[model samples]
Target: MTADLDHPRRGGLWHHPEFRRLWIGESISQFGSTISQLALPLVAILIVQASTFEVGLLVMFEMAAFLLVGLPAGAWVDRMRFRSVLILNDVLRALALASVPLAQWLGVLGMEQLYVVALLVGVCTVFFDVAYQSFLPQLVEREQLVEANAKLQASESVMQISGPSVGGLLIQVLTAPYAVLLDAFSFLWSASWVAAIRTRPAKPERRPDRNLRREIGEGLRFVVGNPLLRPIALCTGAANLFGSMATAVFYVLLARELSLSPGLIGLLGSTSAIGGLAGSFVARRFAERVGQGPAIWISSLAMAPFGFVAPFVQRDWTLALLAFAQGAMWLCVVVYNITQVSFRQGLCPPALLGRMNATMRFLVWGTMPVGGFLGGLLGSMIGVRQTLLVVAVGGALSFLPVFLSPLRRMRELPSYAATV
Candidate 1:
């Protein structure tokens, strides 16, 4: 039985039946999500005729769940069945997304409906993600995490690479509003596969002393009180904040100012996917050579200069600069995320996995909505190009937290990271 699992001494995750199920389910959903990431906004822009602020607000609504339920949701997920939570969210997201095209077909679709759908999706995502992270430890041995995460990220990379271009063309052919139906159906497919996963996650250890506030506080302290985890949170949080600022208006810039078609805009999205694919491909080897800790900070600074290249993009040959910058950023981030996520996952106690991941998500992804709003505000004030420059400048320094930490001096991180 052990020999058939994802043991390195065994055949790795490919031989792990349950992990393969999760991967196939997640990969298909990711492809759909990737396409919808482009299609949804295009629906807002082209069909709904949303303004810049409205578009940014759309982004905010999509991510607002992290701020609202990110903490307590983790605690709640800890108590629930992982399979139930996963399947429920997948179904809910499918229903919510399906509503988009239905409303359009009925000639009743509006920004209000879109915003509500985005919020519902965000809420489900918050729960699903927390449960998913915690569920992984039960699915495989501790040693298999990096390999598992890399494979998962690799599939995600492929989806991202192809999804945008395909989505862009689909948007043009089917019209953006109807294009969302693909993602709607994909969620159903994801749910079916998740229901088929045979690995039953044991019911969580029950504690009579469980309190939401106290549990949340415990998770917070575990992250914030630790030197290594603290810096990663800060670095990731900062990068996301500033990155969101530029991305808030990125579509607007491409569609409105640059006058690019949906197909072209989507092709540009491929730059990051290309980078992400490279990062996933080389992540394990790169960490081995450079040291896991070094990989984190080195990848961070290596892409710093790329941020400055984005705002300088032109309609001509310089388009490649934006692509390069986007790709470089994704490349670095994928490597950084794969390493750091494995580190943190391996670091926490099983009971704390949900909370630790939730706390981390709050710290990192919570900034996205705020940044989106800021990007919109700044775009109105400083113009889109200048706002991107600000994002670039601030993003260049996001690696400082990790760089200044003790991890900078270490070679590899042990699962049992003892540094305070």
Candidate 2:
């Protein structure tokens, strides 16, 4: 490290070696995981020819572990070395995913196996996320957070565009279970890359709060009672719940009701990543100018409109254009999310970050089951398009909580030294 204070790091992304490795590994893994995300459901529905209810159950099962294991995992992560936790998580997930392909080769792949794999992978994912977040602050200076987040958002946008196309093609050629093998390899790659990055290990046995309950409660209070985190939790939770509802029925609407080909839908889906990329490209500049809070609010407001437009997608390339628009809205969401994470990482005490992240996700992601269930119920009764419309309206409208709260003016993370 150079001693010149004036010459600070240039090229936000290029400055941090660990962040660069992490970003590269993450980007590759995201592409692979996104493919699995699409392939999993397709396998459930198309290959097994499962009913809509079964598909819904599969999705719910995948998300259920987050609810079951998140907080406890958070407590555990706080007591361990985050780098080792992340590496172990990747390895576990890789083995679990690798099994699906092996089972498929043996002609014994079943719904039970799929459910079990989904649940296990979800559990590993929860641990990885909590631990990884706790480890992020040590990788870069606090001021560089927005830049790092922007880079992450950019990678996610690219994955959004390409991952589905690759997944669809792989599924077409190798079958869904085999497609997951690509994800397994990606996770292994990620673990290898993470192991290569050198970082100071977090000292084990440094428990901050006594008793799991108190630690959990401290984390929860930070998120739920904070001036910034509270509204973010509410808005994002509503978005996830309703967005899941709308998306749960999306393939049925596009493929069955609208008579879209899988290739075309995948193509349309790819266009959303373009919007996401563009949104990320602009978000850092926008956030820097107007503040993180306002950027998030803007993203929140746009979410519903883009979602509402889905049902109105006309035939021909118009559908592609509408998909592109939705992608742009998704980009806004990515920017907002990255900004929020950057702020949270910078503001929270390092010792409490794991619990805070876990607690926040528990509340936000816990809505996934409800959304999946509602999507199925509503699609069955009121029809898919109508159901999606309702979710779009309801989810977007839920942003009112953040808009009315103290969040609107919170432009940046208050200095870490500032006490709540």
**Best candidate, TM-score-wise?**
1
Model 2: per-residue lDDT, tens digit, 83-202? 888899999999998998898788888888888998999999999989877877767667777777788779977987998887777777888788899999999998888887777554
| lDDT (Cα atoms) of all candidates against the true structure | 0.88, 0.79
TM-score result, candidate 2: 0.93
Instruction: For residues 135-224, write the lDDT of model 1, one tens digit per residue.
Output: 888888887889989999999999999999999899989998778899988889999998998777578878988799999998999999
Superposed on all Cα atoms, the candidates' RMSDs to the truth, in angstroms, are 1.9, 2.5
lDDT of 2 at 34: 83
TM-score of each: 0.96, 0.93
**TM-score of decoy 1:** 0.96
Clashing pairs in 1: none
| Clash statistics: count for each candidate | 0, 1
| lDDT value, candidate 1, whole model | 0.88
